[model samples]
Target chain A: MSSFEVPEVSNKQVIFKNYVVGKVNDSDLEIRTSQLRLELPEDGTNDVLVKNLYLSPDPYMRSRMKEDYTSYVPPFTPGKPIDGYGVSKVVLSKNPAFKEGDYVTSFTRWEEYSVIPGGNGLKVIDTSESVPLSYYVGCLGMPGFTAYVGLYEILKPKQGETIYVSAASGAVGQLVGQLAKLAGLYVVGSAGSQQKIDLLKEKLGYDVAFNYKQETDYNAALKKYCPKGIDMYFENVGGKMLEAVLDNMNKFGRIAVCGLISQYEKENSDGIHNLSRLISARITMRGFLQADHANLQPEFLQKMLGYLKEKKFVYIEDIDEGLESAVGAFVKLLSGGNVGKQILKVATD
Target chain B: MSSFEVPEVSNKQVIFKNYVVGKVNDSDLEIRTSQLRLELPEDGTNDVLVKNLYLSPDPYMRSRMKEDYTSYVPPFTPGKPIDGYGVSKVVLSKNPAFKEGDYVTSFTRWEEYSVIPGGNGLKVIDTSESVPLSYYVGCLGMPGFTAYVGLYEILKPKQGETIYVSAASGAVGQLVGQLAKLAGLYVVGSAGSQQKIDLLKEKLGYDVAFNYKQETDYNAALKKYCPKGIDMYFENVGGKMLEAVLDNMNKFGRIAVCGLISQYEKENSDGIHNLSRLISARITMRGFLQADHANLQPEFLQKMLGYLKEKKFVYIEDIDEGLESAVGAFVKLLSGGNVGKQILKVATD
Candidate 1:
């Protein structure tokens, strides 16, 4: 325990300035610097002091910035460091399960240093894998598992069946398209830009990709792509897209409601018109949380690692330089400025 | 094979004049009398000529009036007698399985006589039960099975859980509330009129009932009734009611979409705005057809009959006098004028 000396450093944090209303901007959060000791306090016998290397900037983080919204996760407090999924190195640990130099992933703060309580949500990652440590905050993390659950467990993709994914170039959507492809499905993805559409088609191996911003009629676009009708829809951007998807869904179709990023920012939601199609088609639409499916995490991680090794799954990350850039990165993410999983590189390995 | 001789009769039929665009009216159908031989033709070896007694006018019939709407059942053609759940007496049969004077229920037309193809959807009722023959067309038939499948198979209500049923005094809604009450659930129902509300609370055993038309804010009304959030929603009238229910739903709530009567007549559906709540609450919304759950029919019948015999479950019917009243009955049923399962008595047994 006394092998090395612990150093005190200035901890940089991305703080939530206030509860955001309507569209989230960089001004919603502020950067603050504070002092932190590398060693645990005398009473912190079950805590691990970690230096955050990479922090995930997710669309769901925008949801947490609001004060009174009811969701699976609680809202972030103002004047405090915002918390999210981050990959970190255990610099000093009083917990028996964790030691110094152990690489782990947890719901840590958007800060350079964090003292995470042991055996709560902290998961030690396998450093033996040649994948980047930041992968734990993106592909090997919550977003990856969300896609797996939505595809295999919710929609249950069948071979030769058609699948349509909204926001398909994003973290979950990209993986969902790839997984549907691996299951021998006719996969089509919709994104906001030409670059994301290209990434979805060329890089992600989607059968068809469309820039939704360019399509005047979403229903016409979906009909053009899914000629046979959509058997499964991985719904990310809801509202008008969901309405169009409902119109193009086949009999006994399934919609896995992963996210509604399109509706999150708006004070009044863009209402869905064709929900009656759900009855005529006998569709099943279910919403789920990744935390609820923790039992499948080991299997998810194993299969994802294997897919990565075989080059069957390709991952992309849009990384900002430091914790100071988190607010800008998150604001950009919400506006669809970045493709794939957006991450803020807090520190180097 | 029979002592009584068959006689030729005038088949009085309610003919669908043309496909209805919006709300159906009496002008959309016409009563026509056609001559028919009571005896089956020698070549009609697999057909049974039945004298229709009672015909059920359901909300789903509105969907069939559309020129090109896809459903589990085919659309009713113009100039043809509309088909529905009917109780009939087999008057002439070339098929050996069904004999003359045998009572059967099938998808029969709004006519005095129908020559249904044998062994195709015909189910002979047990007349020994001492229940009314018209019950086979309403409470003890297709509507009953629909409620059973939705409550037992789909929602699977837990004791003490809260349930909200829309279109409360109608065919399936009445049964769903009764079933939920039988399961010890705190049941609340929403109907369009005061009479239906009274029927729900006083007659149908719903713990609370509201006239949805009278309520300015449905969410507030639901919140007042179901202080504990809705655990299961038996959806009958969709559109605004569904949107309100979504807002008042508890986490892990289940919604069994039986029918969307509110949206059937509208050209453009009233869009649901609060669907994003489905994700936050982790709701499971499913749409089902009674045909898909044929295996549960026998069990449903046994339990329903038992409940009826014990006076544990009450049945209601808004019976119209003759086949001449068919168009009026159907029109009224769509507008929520009928209190219970609307039945058109085509003939007396």
Candidate 2:
């Protein structure tokens, strides 16, 4: 019945070499090639084959590199492709939900191709407009939803209130500032670089942005930038930054604990003092995972799509070309090497 | 026409000598006698003259001793009497809210008699329930209300969930343990000494109790006692104990930061590390004051009164006699010297 032989494909991949310790290095991951038949397995299993286009290089991934880390995501298997959120095109499908040529955002391996069982978590992308495919793995993906849920759902930003976003130029922080601004909040931000600070203040519509690395005292910087005091905090970088923010928060302030990117690679995470301020200020510090707020996805997509269509939202992605650049992009994302949302561009069209 | 000639009285008082810097001592306070005519001022300030009966000496008073401290209540004036909640009888009333010879709980200074302007914050005691007048300063006053609000409103414990309370034998903590127990929670507590530990487990109905002073590693102690992981925490003692509790909390756990007595007298508060767990565990840490939820007082009174009337609650007080002992009782309360609620019995009948 086969008119021609199915062509084999060379699947290039980024494989995690071992359980990482302390800070990660380029050597911890290796770019290699493996043979693939480009077909579903013979076993009676419902699965879909997808060719990955772009992969997100996120800071939260650092926690999963440890052998015995506590996180929602499990540790990466040694000698296996690193798994993460990515944009892909369904190459083949045995599941009724997905078909060939369907463009989707999915939990895919860090490889040219991945076989997703039951086509689970494959969200079909609405590529109706002129939006780039790479944005699906960055601004319109998990990172974007994280910003939405963390701000609107958790912190519940009110009009005329002030919100401080740390790591302001990063994936989640950038969008949080913009969303808070749209919601009529006085948005303030702190980033490591002058470039990101500029982006936050100018392009992202933050009321004020400061270079935290240049600022000798975070508390003083917060006071100078946010004169009225911070009413809400989107905490990304932790340790000393958290302590300072806690001191400056207004009465009944809320803190959305999204990520502690700065402390991820440290041998011992920084100690946060000044928690006595929590009682004095009646602060509510809540740590959250976007997966827990999956109920907000549909609304998040509609609102974010509207912002993009209206050109009201600025989605910045630092896309590294080729699959081989994934490790570098990931390392940059963790080390604040990238200027914006870090992503690895694996394919075009 | 005067019904009787007013008698001049010598008021024995404890006055704050100065703004205390380090740990408090007996020298920081002075017991002095001052003359009182027991008459309202001629300017008609609508004040009431109160005969002070029982005085509450609490850990929260330690913060007021500092010149630059931030609290809902302002710092103590150097030349004025130390103010606290106390049971008193209105000897003379110009304000219609209180009448002569009526027993009430009011914010009065640490003295035998106090002239309160406008009868502000005075709650008349029924004396019909047969509850002791001193109970108003201990179990039925701020500390009891503190435990009520912290457990029910902030922590919101669920049946069968585990609750860990620090400073478990102290004023607020003892009530929190008993109330949480009544709420069908698995209550684990930690105190400074073995006697307090016995009181917590044997009498207060805590499922388990440990001496934090004896436990070398607080985290280890929590793990051993709270085998199921802590879902709700009544955080009375902060610093290292808070650090340990944060690590032991379960996902989506809640911490009611009622008091941080351990850090109140310290020059520098302890640094809370492992806040990264706040994100991983998706915890909610809230610091609250019972005064903020003042509306709950009537209900707190009704429920607590029922608990007492039905002989369901045990209220213990380590009462030191007279105004002269106020300083020592207060210092003992701060140093964990008292077995239960620490209060000064200013006068009987």
| Most TM-score-accurate candidate | 2
Give the local distance difference test score of model 1. 0.89
As a whole number from 0 to 100, the lDDT of residue B285 in candidate 2 is 90
CAPRI accuracy category, model 1: medium
TM-score of predicted structure 1: 0.94
Calculate DockQ per candidate and list them.
0.75, 0.81
Instruction: Look at candidate 1 and tell me the lDDT of residue A138.
Output: 75
RMSD of each: 3.1, 2.2
The sequence of per-residue lDDT tens digits that candidate 2 reaches over residues A118-226 is: 8889988877866888888767888999999999889998899999999998899999988898999999999988888889888988999999889969999999999
Q: How many residue pairs clash in each candidate?
A: 0, 0
lDDT of 2: 0.89
Please provide, for model 1 over B138-160, each residue's C-alpha lDDT reduced to its tens digit, 9 standing for 90 to 100: 77888988998999988988899
- Candidate 1 reaches a DockQ of 0.75
Clashing pairs in 2: none
